[model samples]
Target chain A: MTTEPRLVEVRKNVLKQNDIIARALRDRFREAGVLAVSFVSSPGSGKTAFLEKTLTLLHSRYRVAALVGDLATENDAARLGRSQVPVKQILTGTVCHLDAAMVQNALDGWDLTQLDFLFIENVGNLVCPSSYDLGEDLRFVLLSVTEGEDKPLKYPTIFNSADVAVITKSDLAAAVEFDEAAVLRNIQAVRPGMEVLKISAKTGEGLAEYLEYLERRCSSSRAGAAASN
Target chain B: MHELSIAMSIVEMAQEESERCGQAQVLAVHLRLGQLSGVVKEALLSSYEMACEATPLEGSQLLIEEVPVEVFCPKCDGPRALGSIQWFCCPECGTPTPEVLHGKELEVVALEIEE
Candidate 1:
């Protein structure tokens, strides 16, 4: 008897299942007239703080809910829930990022058509989150002034993947000696024609602009979907 | 790390493939990894071993083929391989091009198995 090991051709994407689920989620979100948005950043980039403020600000005007992901704790979901919005925490345990399956599972029992906007705050990591699209209409990538100006250039993939780049903790820019020009230049260098925003959730500075942007995003996304349909 | 999850996914995929091939023993899983795939090769390889333990892929090998980034350059009127990581620009004309032609692959291409 002869022993032989044969090579079998099985060409398939490892993430094909995730992609299919994500596409279904996106279609459902669009049909329900809900804007699904996500936020990603490095740890301590003020994503939770910014989301807390956003939830509070938009809660009165729109039916808002959030899914917060963390490696270990539900602290972020607890904090965001204080705004009195439906908040759920997806504890990924050791996973560095949230996938579409997690997002879909978390939305169980909730009618998406009832909400105007649904936010998913991803696990605080710039690299991994970029690779996983959670069926979001828009993704905001956050960077704090304290992180240094070259952050976007250092992690260009995240910057390139995000629909918008947010500069958080603007109120502390002066104290931290943050160079706005350098940061802007770096962002432009890495992802040209990228939309950037500056905001401070603590002081409400630029919050108005941020909200307006969100409103515009919701409307435009819905309008685009309606037109395409 | 997410690499562990991805490694598990690979193992699961291998098991399915083996089952489809009449319960053949998978000797190795071949993968095509791209630079833009966002997975660190070393981390994934280490995670693969751990994920395979106590599973059908326990002694199997993961063979990875790294794909280089390629961009569609309008200035060059064609796609070009990015030689360096400094920028996504056309090497000949130095014009920035965001149109990616390749290097996002994270596919399981083949399997070495024995009946």
Candidate 2:
């Protein structure tokens, strides 16, 4: 005998697995007193160069490391390894974005306590990375001047998901005639009150301010952990 | 692009639920997809069937409910429907709100199963 079809309520989140893992990672980061920063952007947004500069700048004074994700090849990881810090390459092999599980796996066996700052550079893709949270304390969405001022508007979900917006390749701003005000307006439209920073790793234009801001955030997180302990 | 993986997750979840219900055949799966979730509905629709292949969910219908982005406007003091995905301002009073009230949902709300 055939039975009738009935609707049953599930009300379950599709990303529940990833979310749980991300929460655990967040807690681990907090307990370990480390500031985790993740970067997302389209291909050729200068995320690697920016991260390389950041890691190099912080390597002398602090314990820092990086995990860079890519579809294939360890080219980025090799480039970042030149910073003389620990670097891991996550080859996704076809996965468009890095999820919490990949991050948790990449960080396995590492002592989070020894690290002052951990940087995760996501597989370069604006669309897919927005959906999966990698459990980073801060998500920086990078936008180069050559990519156009409307990049934020074109990819609003990513802008909304990110904590900060970095306009990279400022050294080519005039060559590309990048309109800073227009990009600012676009970012404000998608994510109101998002912290935006313009930096050019090539010439060390805004790295000092960005580095100081990062150090401040790291110190605050460490202080928070201390107070709690 | 990642919808295939997402679809696979949905199928896995539904399969487990179906098994819990004495291995009932899932006739249809109801999903709530939000605009701000960064998932394209059409992409998911195409990927759903592929994900269900060789599984109990094969040939089952995937019903999707699109959820629009809503933000809590400070000036309005209420939830406002976002005018556009790119614009987070209230369509009514034009107040910009950083607080997102909803539209991030990607959930399996219900399942139609044949007993």
Candidate 3:
């Protein structure tokens, strides 16, 4: 008998299971008619403040819920709860970023069909969050005016992966001498034809336009799903 | 860093693959890491050691193969390695190319196990 060992060729992505779960979540969200939006940014970029403003604006008309992720402390979740909408805190402990598994676990026991919008506030870190998809219908990457305008260039992967870019704290632009034009240019350079919106959560500026854009996206996706069905 | 998390995933995948192959031990895991994959190779290597401790993949080495960013330059009518991340101009001629052929790849290619 010839002594030969069989060599098995197995080519698979380590994140294959995670990707499958994420896809399932996406389909579930679509079927439930929930417009899921997620936010990712570096710490101190006003993500919590932005979400607070968004919840305040959206809760009046739409049934909105939020899931905020952080390394520790429920300060953000507590703060967002003031909006009088359902909010959950995902304490990742030592994890630098939130993954799909975390998102799914956080949503446990909550009826997604009851909500029109779901916002996932990812842990404040730019690098790691871009690698994992949390099954959100839209992913927004936020950059503050105080942050360098070349942030998009420095962290191209985050900007490239984001569906939309939000320039937060625009009220501080003039005080900080922020280069708005350069920031826009850098965003375009990294992801051409990407949707970018400028907003100031403190002053309530540009909030209406952002909401309108979100409404349009949700409706369009709904139309597409209807047609496919 | 997120390297630890990635390393943990690698170890888990290796263990599962070893079990599927009816092997008692994993020798190594081959990974294809592209230049633009946004993963630091040194950090990953160090984290791999820490992540594999007391796990099935203990003592298993992580073999990484680096891949350069390649883009299709319309001017050259072929693919060429991008020297830098900032500029994607043609290597042979001075022309900007918008087509991306390779880059941003982070995947485990294969596993070596003892049967």
Highest lDDT model number: 2
CAPRI-style quality class for the chain A–B interface of candidate 1:
medium
Pitting candidate 1 against candidate 2, the one with the higher DockQ is 2
Q: What is the per-candidate TM-score for chain B?
A: 0.97, 0.97, 0.92
Q: In model 2, which runs have C-alpha deviations exceeding 4 angstroms?
A: none
Per-residue lDDT tens digits for candidate 3, residues A1-229, read 4334333455666667777878988998888888999999999999999999999999989999999999989999899999999999999999888889999999999898898899999999999888788999999999999999889888877876788999999999999999999998788766656789999999889998999998898788888777876
lDDT of 1 at A130: 74
TM-score of each predicted structure versus truth: 0.94, 0.99, 0.90
Candidate 2 residue lDDT tens string, A14-50: 9999999999999999999889999999999999999
Each prediction's Cα lDDT score? 0.90, 0.94, 0.85
Q: List the residue pairs that clash in candidate 1.
A: none
Docking level of model 3:
acceptable
What does candidate 3's lDDT look like per residue over B1-115, in tens digits? 7888888888887787788887556778889877666678999999999999998888888989888878777778899887666555566774665456777667888876666
Q: In model 3 chain B, which range of ten residues has the least summed lDDT?
A: B85-94
Instruction: Give the poorly placed runs of model 3, Cα more than 4 Å off.
Output: A1-8, B70-83, B87-101
